[model samples]
Target: MSKLLEVKDLAIYFDTYQAEVQAVRGVSFELDEKETLAIVGESGSGKSVTAQSLMRLTPMPPGKFAGGSILFNGEDLTKKSESQMESIRGKDISMIFQDPMTSLNPTMTIGKQIAEGLIKHQNMSKKEAHNRGVELLKLVGIPNPEKRINQYPHEYSGGMRQRAMIAIALACNPKVLIADEPTTALDVTIQAQILDLMRDLQQKTGTAIILITHDLGVVANAASRVAVMYGGKIVETGNVDEIFYNPKHPYTWGLLSSMPKINNGEEELQAIPGSPPDLADPPKGCPFVARCPYAMKLCENHMPEYTNLSDTQKTACWLLDERAPEVEPPESAIVGGAKVHG
Candidate 1:
């Protein structure tokens, strides 16, 4: 697939009274046409911020674009005006935010909400848009969409509301979809349904997806590629199989180790020790240095460059250095496509 979006050395910072939050520090990634790329990490790892920066969606009074470019089909979106971005937003790169209740307007009917994008971007008439809105609702697996379209957001169940949000996002047939923790508030079953619905829709529409979430299970199920983030930067990126089967970075190993497993009955889940660093005064070296049990002197003093493991796999860790001590990720952590070893 061709590259649909490329974010290069993107940086975002928030100027607050007490400190400057380096929310996104030179983060970069790519999304290919009709592919799903999952950005997985703990909260505050800059996953949402990085995705939001793609649309210039972050509030700017305090938040500023520190550096870098968001290129969509070779066009630098950073240079586009808010007006220009508005034109691109729903039509080309729509987003499904984490919460639907807050994202949808309480005052408007779900049909009207979905219709708004169609009317604005597609230039459809009110009646036409309304009819299309019902179709969108149906497309996202909403039953009785025609009747439900006239109902308010409060009238819908949580899962239904999320479906409506997806309906609105897909209303404009966006080429790229950014789903920022779309399943965060749903129950397990509903999350599965939503994810399944998204995959089904993607198959039908050929929309490339940027799925930002902390759930590795979701990443395993939904993504073609994975980008692991830590302390406001991408620590590792690779195709799903390589990431799960041959993860290189210690941070990636820690993340994989921490996931809850089904077959390991009564086994306590492993959690990575220590918290992510405060970005305001982040470390001069590797941000994972403080928490890494495998930390070495070089890890504490200098950041490792991203080493190419394969054409599609890359990792940033001193452990990959030719002279570094030979170490292997715990066999238990290899749980994506490969067998889990004892």
Candidate 2:
């Protein structure tokens, strides 16, 4: 697969009365054609902000990119003018948010919302756009799409609304789709259905996907590659198998141990104990140093550079600091795929 979107050293910071908040710091990644990339992290880890910055959506006054370039299809999105970005935002790169109700217009008919994008980007006639709208609705698994199209946002259930959002996002046949917590509000069954629909659509349309989600389970099934974030930086990144089987970052280990296992039951879910560091005045060494179970003197005083484990595996952790004290692997990480810290 070819590269469709590439982000280089992107940083989004906010100026506040209290202090500056570095929501996204020096993050970089690429989305290949027909491939799904999962950005997994706890809340406030800057995953969503990193997604928004690609569209230049961050508020200028408070949210500013200190440094970086958002390269989309060989063109620099950061260099584009506001008017130019407007044309690219939805047509070339679409997004589906967590909540569909907030995204959809209450007054407009659902059909009109989907058709509007078709008419604008594809330059379709009213009749053509309307027909396409119904087709899109059906494509996302909505039954009786033709009749449902005329209904307002309130008429549909939560899952249906989300499907509508997907239909609208896919109306223009974008090269890439950024879905930020797309399954958040729905129940397990609906979430599975929606995820299946997305996977099917991806296979059919070959749309590069950036799946911004916190769920490790979702990452396991949905992504080809995963980038795990903590305190605005991607501390661990690799192919899904490498991430799940050979996780190098202590943060990744913490996340894996925290995942609820059927046999182990609920109470055994081991969450990372400490809160994320304050981005305004984040730790100088490693952001996860406080929460890391194996933090050392070196981990607290100096930031560790990213260590290359393989072509598809990379992690930033002082635990990987060859000079640091050797430590044993966590007992909870005993599994077929999982490997001891290198």
Candidate 3:
């Protein structure tokens, strides 16, 4: 697959009175054509911030681009003018925000919402766009699209609203789709439906997707690759199987361990100790060092460099250093009763 988006050394900071909050620090990742990359991290880990930056969606002044280049379709988005970004946003890349209720215009009919992009970018007539809007709704598995398109967002169920949001995003057939916690507010069944819909859409449109969420279970099913973020940085990245079956970073282990595992009789979920570090004054060394059970002195004094476990897997941790002690992940992190060596 060819590279569609390349975010190089991306950094975003929130300028506050007391300090500059380092929301994202030197984050880099690539999205391939027709592939789903899941950016998994806890709340405030900067995953959402990074996604927002792709389309220059992060608010400036209070939220500044500290550093980095977001290269989409061989152009640098960070340097693009607002006018230039406006052309790219819905036409080339689109976003399905976390909350459809707030993202969608409550007053507008579903057809109008979807038709807005088709009219603006594709220059379709109102009747043409309106017809296409119904097709989009049906494309996303919404029932009775023609009837539903005439109704407002309030008339739709939560899941249906989300589907409408997706329909609006795919209206222009953007090359890239950013779904930020797309299924967070939905129940399990609806979440599955949304995920399946996204996968089906990808198969049909060949649109590369960036799925941002804190859930590893979601990643396991929908993502082709995974990037684990913590303390405003990518601590680990690999294919889905590598991330789930052989994760290297302690943070990744903690996330997996915390997920509720089925068929593991009498096993309680293991939560990671301590909250994420304060980004305003981030730790001097590794951000996760304070909470890591096997943290060594070096881990507290310096941040570890990325170590290539394989061509497809990379992680940053002192434990992966040549001289560090060998330590296995805690039993609680073991998935399906199998160990993941460190």
Clashes per prediction?
0, 0, 0
**After best superposition, candidate 2 residue 291: deviation in angstroms?**
0.8
Question: lDDT per model, in order?
Answer: 0.91, 0.88, 0.90
lDDT of 3 at 77: 91
Alpha carbon lDDT of residue 212, candidate 2? 97
> What's the candidate order when arranged by decreasing lDDT?
1, 3, 2
Worst 10 residues of 1 by lDDT: 333-342
TM-score of each prediction: 0.97, 0.96, 0.97
How would you encode candidate 3's per-residue C-alpha lDDT over 27-110 as one tens digit per residue? 999999999999999998999999998988988979988888988878889999999999998999999999876888999999
lDDT of 1 by residue, 264-323 (tens): 858888999899999998888998999998999998879889999999999999999999
Query: By the lDDT metric, which is better: model 1 or model 3?
Result: 1
- Residue runs of model 3 more than 4 Å from their true location after superposition: 337-342
| Residue lDDT tens for model 2, 1-342 | 678999999988999999999888889898889899999999999999998888887788788888989999899988898999989978999999988768889999999999888888889999999999888998999999889999999999999999999999999999899999999888889988889899999999989899999988788778899999999999989998888777888888888888776665545667889899999988888889998888888888787889999998889987777776777657565344433221
